[model samples]
Target chain A: MLAGSQNRVQCTEIVLFGVNVAMSWAAVQGWFHKLASPPHFYVTAGRWVPWLGASTVVLLAVGLGWSLFIAPLDQYQGASTRIMYLHVPAAWMSIFVYLVMAGSAAVGLVWRMRLAEVIAASSAPLGAWFTFLALATGSLWGKPMWGTWWVWDARLTSELLLLFLYLGFMALQAAIPDRRAGARASALLALVGVVNIPIIHFSVVWWNTLHQPSSILRLGKPTIHPSILWPLLVMAIAFKLYYMTVVLLRARCALLERERSSAWVQQIVTEQIALCHPLR
Target chain B: MIVDPQTSPRLGRALRTVLVRDLTLALRRRGELANPLVFFVVVVTMFPLGLGPEVDLLARIAPGILWVAALLAALLSLEAMFHPDYQDGSLEQLLLTPHPLAVLVIAKVFAHWLTTGLPLLVLAPLLGVLLQLPESATGVLVISLALGTPTLSFIGAIAVALTVGLRRGGVLLSLLTLPLYVPVLIFGAGAVDSAAGGLSVVAHLSFLATLLILAISLAPWAIAAALRISLE
Candidate 1:
């Protein structure tokens, strides 16, 4: 009888495990479907925007302060090295945002998801801004150290090309009158342009070696001191948060514009009107 | 849904029809076909005049100038790739055909290369002489243009397909394509530079060939996808 009970218990345990796996899978699917729905996404993003914005502001302030003041000076670059706190994070985010845009674009194209398109359109300008910041700051840093306003370095040139790509994406999106078509068209351009980033980097590196030989060596290549590295990491996270905040804001605006005729948008507008008039 | 096999052509026949039709249209519009070639010569000519007639200086910069001009000229012709078809509703008809759209796009791009890129390849050596590019490098210059220009047409076709439905797409098309053109420009010009320096041109030529292979294989599907998006 005890042996029989043990076998029954083992069977029940296996059954429970299978049921748990199936339950979690359904839950994940349910969550994905809810997020894909525009109204659900709008609500979820609206709720998170304030927290993301707050964290971005707080983290950026702390990171910048620490980087500029508290971080140890570079043995070679000295105070000029502080520019890296801004440049590196901005550069990282610029590339990261493009990948995100491209990923979202691919998702939108494959699944025909409306929210994915909104995310892509919203991310382009922010990506452009970060890329511009990277170039401008890199130029500023170069002038003092390299003794020139610019050098045709691989990273710098690729960053410049990235800026042009962003402009092209925006131009393509704006030129197409239909919103959905424009989204898909720009998405295709974004995907195609992603291939150039690596080529630009490598070609510029090859060109630099061919032309300049050893004039400009890579700066800050040795292991970074923790004092400096920590703030840089903080700044990178802050920039990511900043991107999230701005993308959410822009996407919310885009969602409203695209879905103005939808029932949920109408309800939101009516609620806003009622809140403002109160007595009417 | 039952139908006679006689009415509909097979995939190969459909692809051939697209190629033949595009070639015939291009031939009929002789002026349009000549525009890019003319633009190439004019642009290449501007550099020597602008920088003064220093033979060595011109020769030093000739490969770059010629390649850049050819790239821009190719771009100028790209707007016409799908604009006429898109306007007259044949692009839609082409999409509706049973043959896959990518095959049709490949045929169209191939015809574009033959019309725009082939002429540029033939005319490059003349520009080489005008720029005083080194005699040894002239062969590599033509070779590079021959290999690289088709890739440009293929890459440029994606941009043109995306913008074909828009009214003011010409300027936007250039903006969209020029960044993507950088690699081809780098490698093509590098091949000539290598040859001029008495180095083996194998590496640069191989790079260009790789780009051509990649562009040919991947760009048609992108162009077809973009065309459908634009049409929708």
Candidate 2:
């Protein structure tokens, strides 16, 4: 009888997942449809920037206020438990953004879409920053919890590898002269690197080693108390919004840089920079 | 429309002729064959010096050390896979042919496997004896090389294609491809270690063969794609 209700809950989650997928698909489609033309993207981005900025501020404000004050502290960890609000979310976003970046890269490769390339290039630096944040915050969390600031734990090691993969992609792109070719090659590299992500995840499970065993705080099911869980959930949502705001901004810059030769770009740049006028 | 059963069609004939010509060119420079072999020997010898002179300890680590050396040597030769042809613009001539570049890449991969990979397998028994690998372990050493070396060739082909045009691309190729090589390293080293422990070699060999098949099926496509991008 309990199994029946549990199955019902799972079915509900799957339905929710489906709805989430459709919503995300529609939202992204609407976003790109407007941004498909370089001039349109530039003008549209100008108008949307304030809204993205405002949404980010509001979400982060609400999320942080609840997490820092309203959410109860963990009995075991005390105030140090607050670190999860920053650490867990940063770590999740770091990995999540790379997958999205790589997916955009794959689309760029398959369709040779200029917008996709802009998105891929834009995603890298931001993803790298988040990855660094994850590692930094993770180290901070580790010092208080695991008794050391750093360990060659499997999860930590894999996170480090992910960072290297990002660096490799960036370096490979910088080395090649032809932008289009570089984009394609880097996209292939990204695709290949993402394949290894799963292997990195399972490396701990597959091997008996010093890495900490899987925790309830990880994906799928939560093993932590409701007190600990609520703050983490809020922080995760905040991080997702933070990533979106930054990625869209960077994508606008990348589109401008790549499409600077277009007439629309010339008009947009002239209009935007006309007030200052040329130094000449 | 004439069909020949034994002899290849015109395109096939061109590919085979090119293959034979390259093989002959390689055979004429027998000293070139010794480069990887000597490099392999030197690399294997360096491990003992670096790790200190403990024979039993050396024996224990021998399989891993030996595979690493072989992997490095294979990588060293990959630079040469397209270097000479690329420099001479002979690769362009071949590309211009009616035959597919993929076939040419396959032929080159085979030639590399023959010249470098085959020699490594042949020399494994000697290395095994020197490292005190035991008679039972010889089969594991041989089989791992047999299965693992093709993977090395296929993967190396992709790296070679990627770096074929750049000057002094050897180190970059090694760094880029080495991480991709970890799975083969794990299984190859595991196979020999398992054999040394009196465990089932069959299971390890099966895994090795699976890796080899996967490499064979997919690596040519990757190599071709990389070549097109680099040469574009």
- Where is model 2 more than 4 Å wrong at Cα? A1-34, A61-87, A136-152, A195-222, A277-280, B1-15, B130-135, B201-203
| Residue A251 lDDT, candidate 1, scale 0-100 | 94
Q: Using Cα atoms with residue i matched to residue i, what is each candidate's TM-score against the true structure?
A: 0.96, 0.81
Predicted candidate 1 versus true structure: per-residue lDDT over A1-280, tens digit per residue = 9999999999999999999999999999999889989999999999999999999999999999999999888778889999999999999999999999999988898899999999999999999999999999999999989999998887888899999999999999999888889999999899998876787678778776776776674556677678878999999999999999999999998899999999999999999999999999
Tens digits of per-residue lDDT, candidate 2, A32-53, equal 7776766677677778777877
Docking class of 2: acceptable
lDDT digits (tens) for residues B1-232 of candidate 2: 3446555457667767777877887888899978999999888878777888777887788888888888988888887778888889888776666556777788878877888899999998888877777678888898899999889888878767776777657766765676667667767877888788778877668767987887787778778777877787
Chain A TM-score of model 2 versus the true structure? Answer: 0.80
TM-score of chain A, model number 1: 0.93
What lDDT does model 1 reach? Answer: 0.91
Top-DockQ candidate index = 1
